[model samples]
Target: MSGLDIDRAAATQMAQKYRNAAEDLESALGGLPASVDGGIASGVLADIVSTLAQNAADLAVLSRVMGGVIDATVSDATATDDSVSESFGGLTLPGEEAAP
Candidate 1:
């Protein structure tokens, strides 16, 4: 009902779409061998690999977007009376802090 709710819904839809796309790509790849009578040509295989890689990249972006949306929604829900720092614990870079 709210803007945050809308964003969460949209993110969920986008994630589902990306999952569908990935499944379709996998199915297409599975069918490739059947489509080619003999073994797949080197050039054709290279092209297929390139396309698959791009699809994978898209999936990654979609996943990241979904995660960001969830994070935003959570932050918004918890941020009414708190500072951003408090709402999100604390920011720390991967290698900036030593492991405990």
Candidate 2:
């Protein structure tokens, strides 16, 4: 069977990119106000913006969490791979029988 092939470095880079996107989103949304000073139209616009901001904040948090999860998962996978490799250090493959 074909084995799993994960690029640990690429996964790490993707995780970092997610975190960076989160940071960028939060930074961009930091100064938006919940309410504005105009009339009914302004109030409606503010409400929309407020809702969007909240959703964006939630998305940012999710992105950061996903990044952390990816990093942790990759680390765990690497550790498990290392442990498995070590466990099989002296073993021979099925077809590579030793001379009697």
Candidate 3:
């Protein structure tokens, strides 16, 4: 399917998967102890936690954006321009022609 196509079921499923993974990371990070061993080990743990937190945030944003992508676009039949498909990496949905 085209990226811009409204595959609601697949989108919902993917969003749910992303959310679950983000939530799992969040829980793991939250449950981590305040400190590891000493010096380098502590720094390493801090870095790992930071990275995980960032990934979780990114995934959450992606999940929301996936759903929002469907909401933010005009239906192909009603759209007056090729701008939408062009915006999505130039991938036109089935039955849409690239503007001349």
Candidate 4:
């Protein structure tokens, strides 16, 4: 069976990057209005802006979700490693003396 071998440091860093991107997108896109007033071709501009904003919002949400998943996966992997290590700590290897 294939085993999981997650690099916690790298995974955590990637998760942080995703979180930062989400924050950046939300901050930048949240200022846009669905419709701007008193400008030529404002209707067309508004429609474009509206679509961009929706897509940005969706992407930001997905980024946040991905970050959360990575964080959770790292946490679970670490827990499993610790558990396995603890379980193995009591065992004596071949040709090795047991602890007194």
Candidate 5:
């Protein structure tokens, strides 16, 4: 973990929490009755529930995408860190102390 940038990991964890919430909401939606009470307003209720389910799905997808972005960002950062270390490894400027 030395010299590692943790912001991307934190973002990935946040996105995972949102993904969990979306899954929970979708699970709850699955248990809803087709028609509560009589048939009146059932269609509207169903449509609302459907829209909510779709929104949850969208949120899950978005969270996943954010996680991917975080992973990519972390990977890029690691690569840059490696490149910088290699470029400066064992190199000393004039009048500067060399790292042991």
Candidate 6:
């Protein structure tokens, strides 16, 4: 009934969606042939590779969005905490950190 409760619920749902998308990407990647045979047409192989690449890109974007939502929810929950401070030592805009 409160804003925090709603944010928590939404964060949970976003996490679940991200998990499902990751699983689907894994399954699709696993289903692809390890190597294409000489008999197979190059165009077919190219198409498969293209599709896989697109799926990977889509998953990456979904992950970014989900991460943003989770971070926003956490920030909202922690807004009143006195000990917490916002800092970006290594994290980039895309949710990854630069290697030290």
lDDT, each prediction: 0.60, 0.89, 0.62, 0.91, 0.73, 0.67
Weakest 10 consecutive residues of candidate 5 by summed lDDT: 1-10
lDDT of 3 by residue, 1-100 (tens): 3444456566556656756665665676577666666576888888887776777767766766664554444334236345645567656689999755
**Candidate 2, residue 84: how far the Cα is off, in Å:** 0.5
Pairs in clash, predicted candidate 1? none
The candidate 1 region of ten consecutive residues with least summed lDDT is 29-38
Candidate 5 lDDT by residue in tens digits, 3-68: 555676676677577667657766776787765553788778778877777887777677666766
- Per-residue error for 36 in candidate 4, Å, reads 3.1
The TM-score, computed over Cα atoms with residue i paired to residue i, of candidate 3 is 0.43
- CA lDDT for candidate 1: 0.60
Model 6 lDDT tens row, 67-98: 66776766667674433334544456676667
Superposed by TM-score, candidate 6 places the C-alpha of residue 90 at a distance from the truth, in angstroms, of 38
List the RMSD of every prediction in angstroms: 13.6, 3.4, 10.3, 2.0, 4.6, 14.9
Residue 70 in candidate 3, Cα distance off native in Å: 6.0
Quality of model 5 by C-alpha lDDT:
0.73
Arranged by TM-score, best first: 4, 2, 5, 6, 3, 1
Candidate 1 vs. true structure, TM-score: 0.41
Best by TM-score: 4
> How does residue 31 of candidate 6 score in lDDT?
74
Q: How much lDDT does candidate 3 score?
A: 0.62
- What does candidate 5 score on TM? 0.68
Clashing pairs in 6: none
Find the number of clashing residue pairs for candidate 1: 0
- Which regions of candidate 4 deviate over 4 angstroms? 37-40
Angstrom error of the Cα, residue 95, model 1: value is 57
lDDT of 5 at 32: 72
* lDDT (tens digit, per residue) of candidate 1 on 27-86: 565554434333658668767766776776677667566666656665575565367556
